[model samples]
Target: MVKKLHKEGSLEPQIEDMINRINELQQAKKKSSEEMVEAQALWESLHRELDSLNGEKVHLEEVLSKKQEALGILQLHCQRKEGGAQRKNVLQECTEQISVHNCQVTESCRQRKLGVQVEEQLENLMSQHKDLWELHMLKQRLTWEIRALQSSKEQLLTEEKLARDKLLEVERRLRSPPEVGGARMVNDGRRRWRYSRGRRLPQTVAPQRTRPAKERPAPSAPAPAARTWSRPQTHRTRPAPSPTPLLRRRPEIKARISDRPPPPASVCSPIPNCFTNRS
Candidate 1:
């Protein structure tokens, strides 16, 4: 818009409009540069956030692996419990058979041998029953523990999945805005270059601008050299302070375009916390 304006116009309205357009373009450039700076700061913050999330992910994975190892150990215990229960059932069947045959022995010597055999078998059965009872109690406890770990593992898996989703979402947010800022800066840069190039003042304007410097000659320690000094220096320092402070402010506006290095501890505006504050 600023480029299309005729700065060499013959009328006052045209000149006024051109100046207005130039100011508007510069203001827009300033705004875009500020946005670019903010976006860059945000980009770095998001990267740091990404690193934090990655570390969290790794930590969670380690915890999950540990849980899995625990689950595996419980599974092994459960298997052993099952095997012991099966062995207990076989021993119980053998005891039942022995009891069923006890009545068949009737004679004196035979009865004595059967009686001794039955006493030994009863002792063995009592010991076996005690062991079976303990095993049953242990099995019950193990089952309860296994169920708890299974439930916990499932919960951990769910949390991991959610974290993964949140990471992706955050990364997506990180990628999008820089493209917009870059395009905005490119277009604004081009407009600023064209406008400045077209409106560059001629060498003749330098002496007029420098004439004010000559008036303030007390600061020019070598007052005699100041006359000869104005020629080379005036052209070089195109941004010589003008009569109006408004003209001085224009350079400040340009300075505002310079990128601000983001502080490491800079606490920015709160990003929407989808990861932690999810409804």
Candidate 2:
């Protein structure tokens, strides 16, 4: 009835309004279709996300179940281990205590041995030092003795040199002549002649007593021809050897040295000690 009324009155206006309503409905339908398509795509994406989440959950649940089983096994093993470890802990504790005690005993023994060795070493060193001191003293005494002997030897040498020089001087005096000037004369009651500067001098004779003429009858035994007197020639005499030359030839007098044997090995050598084991 209303459409008939609209058709009778202004049907063209009603038709245009109807057409606009239809176009609006068609546009709403198109918008609704687009909205439905977008919703469907969003729903599909959400469903896919849900499915992946569900798969991850399932996997996680399965892993959890396995882990729980493993945990149960571990708990049982732990119970067994706990029961066994009690005896093992006690045994280990005892072994450690024994080892510690042995180490301590060894340390004490080593310290005592080391102390004894140190004392022995100290004693040996002292003995060696004493021996060295004695040797040093002996060397000093010997050195002093040597020096004294050297000084005595020097003195003897000097005295011998002086004696040698005196001997040589006496030799020189004995070899030379006593007088060097003109010839000497010996005037006794009778005259004595001597050579002077390589020439012989005339001798003066003493006066003789006169004989009586009466006693002289045999003059015919003519007096022997007057004896011609010639001067005596001088002769050279050999000089005697000087005794000083022979006396001065003194033999080389060396000091008499007694050979002394070396000291015994016991006195000269050091005492021996056997090597000790370290372990």
Candidate 3:
């Protein structure tokens, strides 16, 4: 209907109204482009703030690691101090034990010396006892010898007295002459006197008798009878006694004393485990 009106030249009012609506659309497009440019500038500012916060976190982590290392070094120094005290106590105990051992060794040496002295005294006493016993035996032997000599002297005295009594009896008998006739008794006395003087008498010394010529014997026959009666035996024989044996003498003895050597000493040393284990 509007196209029919324009062709007939009755449409001037409708054409002016179309040209005003086209100008209003152009102004709204220009205002939307200006708002998009402002939003892009705000996004760039937020990205720079996030990068600065990351650098500050890294620096804080390095500081924490250094503080932990310093605490560990302090703990190690405290443990070393406690170990030194324990070592000093062990050294003191070792010194005390060594002193006790030294005292025991000194006592043992003194006892050994005393025992040696006692043994020497006992040996001397035994030797003295043996000497005394030998002297007593010698005294007894001398006493026996003296008694034997006294008994022999007494026996000799008795034998001498018996010989003297026999001699006196023979002298008394000769003093009283026998009466055997006149001339015969006188002749016997003269013969005894001649025998005492150690002289032999002749056969013809008797007084001559007055005999006839035929009664006298031949001189040669009477000579043998006279010789047999002239000599008389006087001495007697006695048997000899057997001799006594001599006594034996004792042998000499020598004594010797010998000393014994001291025994060897033994020593033992213990291994030190404490020093080896420490290494």
For this target, which candidate reaches the highest lDDT against the unseen true structure?
2
Candidate 2, 28-86: lDDT as tens digits: 99999999999999999999999999999999999999999999999999988997798
lDDT of each: 0.53, 0.58, 0.42
Q: Candidate 2, residue 140: CA error in Å?
A: 83
Give the per-residue lDDT of model 3 (tens digit) for 147-206: 433443343344334434533453454444422222113332122321211122222234
- What local lDDT score does residue 64 receive in model 3, on the 0 to 100 scale? 62
Clashes of each: 0, 0, 0
Best by TM-score: 1
Q: Rank the candidates by TM-score, best first.
A: 1, 2, 3
Question: What TM-scores do the predictions have?
Answer: 0.33, 0.29, 0.27
Lowest summed lDDT window (length 10), candidate 2: 270-279
Quote the lDDT for 253 in model 2. 18
lDDT of 3: 0.42
RMSD of each: 80.8, 23.4, 24.7
| Shift of residue 152 alpha carbon in model 3, Å | 11
Q: Please report, as a residue range, the 10-residue window in candidate 3 with the lowest summed lDDT.
A: 247-256
Q: Which ten residues in a row have the lowest lDDT in candidate 1?
A: 189-198
